[model samples]
Target: MSSTHAVNKTIQEINEKIKKGTAVVLNAEEMIDVVRKKGKVQAAKDVDVVTTGTFSPMCSSGVLFNIGQTMPPTIKTSHVWLNGVPCYGGLAAVDSYLGATEPAEDDPLNKVYPGQFKYGGSHVIEDLVRGKVVHLRATAYGTDCYPRRELSRDITLADLPEALLLNPRNCYQNYNCAVNLTSRLIYTYMGPLKPNAKNANYATAGQISPLFNDPYLKTIGLGTKIFIGGAQGYVLGAGTQHVANPERNERGIPLSGAGTLMLKGDLKKMDERYLRGVSVVGYGTSLCVGVGIPIPILNEEMAWFTGVSDEDIDMPVKDYGYDYPNRLPRILKHAKFSELVSGEIELDGKKVPTVPLTSYTRSLEIANELKKWISEGSFTLTEAQEEIPSN
Candidate 1:
């Protein structure tokens, strides 16, 4: 067997082939078919890169805005608001962080509107990115050098020197399917859960997930370029609560939550369709982020990893009805994405329908789009500047 460091050599070979117009690249879906027809050995020899992608509701997301100078008498703002939702004003006078799930201060729990977070931080960011004027208000104590007490203005993304969607946590490697056994329906970020185990809702892009294809974080790390919301982006680091260690099957696929990514991209270049403002019933609002990462087929092992089928990826089914304050929910059973996508799974001797909160169709579109970019030389792979933590 070749040393794992062969990845560097493979990168050089791919670059040389690209210059000669002889490189072979494929998306995750197409690579799966090729592997199935020709086996991993031959497929690895033919394919140089495989693109993977996902589109899921990421709650631990936000945007950082560096709103430029406020007219004269610049005040070191102590408080800031974006579309009625309070933002982190601790950064400098004109910098703030707008969280995805943060509701307006007047309706913290969505009491008045109940689930329809009409003007939350995510919506404010979306409006600004779309070139719509967004309400911005700030208050500060008077200082000798900067003595402006309050300021209010309408601003678009272009008005800010830096408007970046820096999501601390976006796509998760794998997630559990949630089911409620209680008599009443419960709404959650995982989607609506029906009573009496009537339905199951899950959120993940199964085999097409970027971290899943690169479970060990071999090639995906800091500085890796990616397609984010139809615009180019890069990996910042390991996402918050990134579980470097998790129970895995024989194929090294995590059974549940595992790797995650912290991504950042220019909001001004993002498309509104790929960055959507979502309102979950009873749950707060969030951003459905579309992310695509191209995995360089460094070797045969990498090719096999990217070609993993949905049926081979297993995740647990957890009962959301159970309350576990300090512990995790008891795993009822395991089911594959293929089983969930089939629309049903057998649990406790009963057939229960399944619902996917993430859009698989959109995920495929992103992967194909990324593949086209690489094939046409519009996008090129970059080696990770820093490796991610595996432990």
Candidate 2:
């Protein structure tokens, strides 16, 4: 059977089973076995949904707070700082955005500690979610109705009536492998890449990543429900720098940059275990986020996509020694996730070891938990309100 051939099922049919509480749902790990044993046709007929998951450090994550009005002399905030990290205060008088990678005022990047953003935004957000006090400072332009020049206070999550984890880019559809071809070691967000391709680091859950299963964003878009940092979340929009249409493989999986999702969830409902503040040595700090998405097996095509294996998913390996942030990276080679996960891959006729930054074990746990949620009727699949951009 051709891989491109369409499957014989409809979204309405899947919704009917969901409505009747008769839908058959499986996690990505479970679907792998089912597809292997029963084949795609039979598996598609048996499964109504497949849940996918990933837990990795995403620097593009952030939190938004709607702090209620202050005491007398209510000020229209012009400058806002949370735990000494400058937050975006241009929204409303009481709104701010605390970015994950935003550094502290005293620890500004310089020649001494270049790119080392130690302890600032992400930590403050974590503290707030954990019900700890965080120092808040704000300066405002006085107004007749809300007259105050400055205010300083310590606040907790309870002080804010509304707080949300609004990450612009949470789960990447696919990512490139980082390898060091030079003689010296390289420090990167993907962890440390050894010299001369001694070891390669890739950050992805492979078969269980949300966007990996729905490479084209077919069934994932605005309003899709997800498991974010161990709490229920929703896809708000296409994430920043979301590469819509990209080069794909024979299995229709993206070879490189593809779709991304902007997720929003209640911070109060999140658990600290799934939302840890991580500081990469020599690099900046980041928030390790755990995200899971239940892909509705609306049709056999969707089922087939969920059944994609590591061997079928190919990703490019880039030279981390190159100026990746400022310029396009030099692609050293292209290898499948299976090859990368095998602990070794051939690069320039030499075998190089590899490591994974994302935890497959945690990903499996999240997927299985989500599977239980769907089976127990605690969670239901949601249809995307709009198709994600393909640009």
Winning candidate number (lDDT): 1
Q: Give lDDT: candidate 2, residue 50.
A: 93
Which parts of model 2 have CA positions greater than 4 angstroms off? Answer: 1-21, 71-73, 107-114, 323-326
The residue pairs in collision within model 2 are: none
Worst 10 residues of 2 by lDDT: 1-10
User: What TM-score does candidate 1 get on C-alpha atoms?
Assistant: 0.94
Q: Encode model 1's per-residue lDDT on 1-391: one tens digit a residue.
A: 3233333336667767766667788888788888787777677777898999898899888999887774674888888898788989889777889998887877655566556565577777677767888888999886897788898998778788998899999889888899998898887778778889899999988888888788888888899999998899999989998899889988788888888889999888999878887878777788889999999888778888988889888988998875422358888888988999999999999999999989999998999988888888778878899988865
Clashes of each: 0, 0
Per-candidate TM-score against the hidden true structure: 0.94, 0.92
Name the candidate that leads on TM-score.
1
Q: After superposition on all CA atoms, how large is the RMSD of candidate 1?
A: 2.8
lDDT tens per residue, model 2, 1-391: 3253445766667767766778898888678887887777777778888999899989999999877785653878888998888999899778888898887787655346877766868888778778889888999888898788888999988888888999998898889898887798878888877887899889899988888788778888888888988899999989998887788888888778678889999998988767878777677778988898988876677777899889878988998786576678867778999998899899989998889888898988888878877777777777789889864
Query: Model-by-model lDDT, in order?
Result: 0.84, 0.83
